[model samples]
Target chain A: MSLNDPVDDETLLEVRDLQKHFKVDEGLISSLLRAMTGSESDYVHAVDGVTFDLKRGETLGLAGESGCGKTTTGMSLVKLHEATDGSIRFRGTDLTDANEEEMVQFRQNAQMIFQDPFESLNPRMTVYDTIAEPLRIHDIRNETARVRRALEFAELQPPDQYFDQYPHELSGGQRQRVAIARALVLDPDFIVADEPVSMLDVSLRAGVLSLMERMTEEFDLSVVYISHDLSLLRHMCDRLAIMYMGKIVEKGPTEDVIEHPQHPYTRSLINAVPVPDPGVGRERVELAGEVGDAIDVPSGCRFHGRCSEYIGDICETEDPPLEAKADFDGSQKVACHLYEPAEGVDSTRVDDVTDTTAPDDSAASAND
Target chain B: MATQDEPSIFADLDDSTVDESEEQVNRWKRNLRLWRETLGEQWRMLTNDLLVKLAMVTMAFFMAVAIFAPFIAPHQPLNRQYETDAELIIADWVDPMFIDSESVYVLGTTAEGFDIFSQLIYGSRAALLVGLLAAVFTAGIGTLVGLTAGYYGGKIDDTLMRIVDFLYGMPLLPTVIILVALLGPSLWNIIFAIIVLQWRSTARVIRSQALSLRERPFVKAAQVAGASDWHIISRHLAPNVLPMSFLYGAFAIAWAILAEAGVSFIGLGDPNRVSWGTMLQSSRAYAALDFGVWWWFVPPGICIGLVVISGFLIGRGYEEITNPELR
Candidate 1:
């Protein structure tokens, strides 16, 4: 649903048409070479036209491979990287237009949990100071009590032992716990957790994830959980959005999307996840080519080059709008020409083969 | 398989009975253990190096003497009336037991009849002050400029780096000479000359370090925390850049002291002050080297060597502390 719908669900954050482009400059000699070769200058579209909503008390998993704009999207949410073009609305307030003073207030309500716990934490600072930093910056007067409460909430108990420990003294899991404690110390409602456990060891990853899950429920936190792992996303995220080359390819309820992925890229990602059953072997749907450069993305559908079920001419000529998939609940949306009846696929016939629950009427209407 | 199964049996039992307090205690114990381990590692590195220990002791001694030089010296090195013209030429050459010649000039006299021992003691004050002042000024300005340029890479970086390049290409000694010529011969002018000529080297080094440090995830974390640019630069960036700045500052002081001495020897220093450089200058001018007056020049030269060596040792010790790979 478009954000214009006057629904009152306390939408904590809304990002629309977010774009970040980095200009690549060729050296003098390289420019001369390019001039001779007639090569055009280029720009990397790090986050191209990303739009999403984060309702209060809901976790939205933004799933994507490396360089797929997930981290860029997270960074833009906090205004760490300025958006080239977009509107980021928080509590119906446009953060994109927020000045320095306004941003400081916004930061008090919104915080971030970084990817690598080892590197994200300041090695020089003790755990107490790291957690206390936000309290000090935001001018939360009751410093000691707030820090103690935050440490307690993060499941780092006794608080006294950890208060004096530096980041290097803590293990990977402990460090991640400290990072979480630091984020929660501000008592923020919304948080962007950017691949928070990706750098931890496999054995320790679950502990961090569980702690996050507990913290999310305990604090009533709305989080944008960014990761490349589909299994973890399915477990933690209420809703899921799969990204490819800086664009959202598919989005739906976590279980719905995982069980019946509509987009080819989403299907490939789901199938790629290793199942626990060693006996039940499934064919790995390996896409033909590598992801295209974000600097110069291919024309029409960005995934056309790597899409398995590409039509003869339609996929190359027209960019597909993100419309409701045929025979699925209106909750699910996919951006692909293959789902459109106008592209020579019959709505009823396609719906019959694809195991989608909703009727094809909405899909057909969107196509028309 | 049996051993693994046995562990799982214990794990299940442990999971069921896991007390939250016990878990907390375990985490605390583990962190404390790790801290102790890292401390041990650092201690091992410190104790294993004989040169570092020797250097530390030497620096401590030099700093102690430099701090207390005023109280320990018998006569004020700057006092001219205590040194008479008669004592300057005749005292050492005339008698074997000239203890009573002219009011406690124990190390004999300069051409101007200044006590050589008193000058050596008080000379450290000027050398140390000028060296420290110039070092601090150069390091502070260089670090600020370097961090800003390197961390926020763009046209600003390009421009500042170009300035660094231009300064780096100029011969440091000649540039100092020209500046001193323009400013006239004085202690302040020498300090200014040293700071202007030496800051570029530190700027280049700090800039390269900042370039690498900016990419560190901690910096990115600071950004995500909604910290203002100034806060991040001062609080986060400056601390990481400080150890290197300190190391550079120590080396810069050594060079500044040497340069000051060179200028003073050439009569570009304070004319009235009885510095080691002035002693060397006057000794040479009076042909103490041509005559058999070894005591006239040897003490000042040795003092200069001691200062340079002590500075070098301190710098070496600091380098070892900051560089984990070497440690």
Candidate 2:
């Protein structure tokens, strides 16, 4: 992977070790009390360290369980939540260091589609005002023309018909479409769609998803689709990154990751999805334990407590780095101790390393 | 829900409503139209409540009486008739058509020989002036403070809320009494006192509301759209919190009127101005109730009650509209 290169001609968004931590304290009084007592203030490590590259006109899916920091990563990419550490470069401009003018320029070229269409739109503003707001903010001319075009693209036909209507007057599908129109009104280069169709009815999901696909292709937009639904990600994304507790455990082509998940966490996540066909019976790989709180995250790997393939003290004591294995092509990377770092090794398979260390799979499972 | 096939009701109408040549004019017209729509919706909600309707009617009567006080009153409020040596008597038998000096008193003459009917009519002006000014200032200051504090929380919220909490400790009547004493008795001073003390409630209420609304996804969406903090507060947050502030404005108006009355009844009213409270104060000095001079004190007292009840009715109706959970 071109991880060493900060800027590439084709890479639209390069996020390196992004982290966003939220204070766990209630209010200022608690902060003052904590200060007076000389105790460490606790924090929710929401997005600890995530790294990804989004190529121009590419759709990257961030698949994770709830609270796994997929949404935070998406938000940080758009500079909605300022990353606590690391860097986010959008078209070679460092978003973290962007000043007022640069920030404004960045905002004009980037947009976000929130999960809840009902809440994402200003209830007081009409459809036209909501879509026209970005144009007004940027002082762009011909706002009526741009807003009408966006509405028409969103499939709200005869845009003038819906201009006066409020979000309350629209159905779930229509409301989501309005939100899409608002995001697209800016003619953004990059878009962060945080579960855009999750709130809509299942029947309405396909239409909105197809609209988004059309938008990505039509605008040549680099997009990040954040969702816990693997099926949705598999359908929309070209490249998929599976996240577990604020870290991407595996990343590869969507088909490769879905068909052959290397990391135990990724395998368990894929297995959790129910198969619609009753004829094709597959063994369900249920993992132990619940998702840990972000406050007191487990030491080594975050998924160690939940992984069924718990490998002894090595898994418990050492943090695993995301590295490509010799068995697979260099494009796929997995973050598990089962796969030794293949950077210096030559043609070393995963089982060859596990045989010398653990002797047997059952023995490693017994260590749990 | 509107679909592609089903066009809106006004689809065929031309853009004649907002065809202004200038951008500022168009924006202003759009805002005015939005306000009209919001107000029309609110009016529909208020009209459903009979008490609110009655309250509006009562307020209209007082406002009309205040606006046309000079035309409505038979004599100047300050015109005291010492030529005839009038005694305090109920003017029930006095003929209003005959403008004789002795029968000129409509409701009755005070011991000071001031026409009670004239005083009562003109008193509405002072009551309304104090109420409207105090309410507007209080609501304006409170809403601004609340939106600021709630939008930029942390230290700002702490400091603003602490100040509000400190002010909330002030007892309304005593604070106004002391304030008027220091400022010297005047209509403006009473209004100033009421505004200073009354705005805290509105600030606290609106702050709580803005705090919750600040977390809504729409607010985040606005931020992502590169809206400045000021624009977000004024354009987005202000409209959302305004209806609640108006509800508080109604309460503030009622409070201001009553506070002015309380301050005036204790002999701190502007001596040059004739308010309902000043009339009550004067009647008390002559023991109008004790002497069976009901018209001297009863009219001003009833006017105060009517205005306060109307305020409560309007507030109740507005509360139901703003928070449908209450309905």
Cα lDDT tens digits for candidate 1, A1-368: 32224656777788776888877877889889888999787889888777777887789999988999999888888877889987899878898787787787788778888888888887766888788777656655555566677777667888887887888888888888888988877667788999898888999888888988887876678899999999999999988999888888887678878987888899899888989999988878998889898987787678999888776465665566554555454456677776643233432431121222222334333322
The C-alpha stretches of model 2 lying farther than 4 A from their native spots are A1-9, A26-37, A344-368, B1-28, B84-102
Q: Per-residue lDDT of B217-293 in model 2, one digit per residue for the tens? A: 88888899899999889878998999899989888888899999989999999999999999999989878778777
Candidate 1 CAPRI-style tier: incorrect
Shift of residue B233 alpha carbon in model 2, Å: 0.7
- Fnat of candidate 1 is 0.25
What DockQ values do the models have? 0.19, 0.35
- Displacement of the residue B248 alpha carbon in candidate 2, Å: 0.9
lDDT of each: 0.75, 0.83
Candidate 1 lDDT score at position A307: 85
Q: Model 1: residues >4 Å from true position, as ranges?
A: A1-8, A28-41, A327-330, A341-368, B1-105
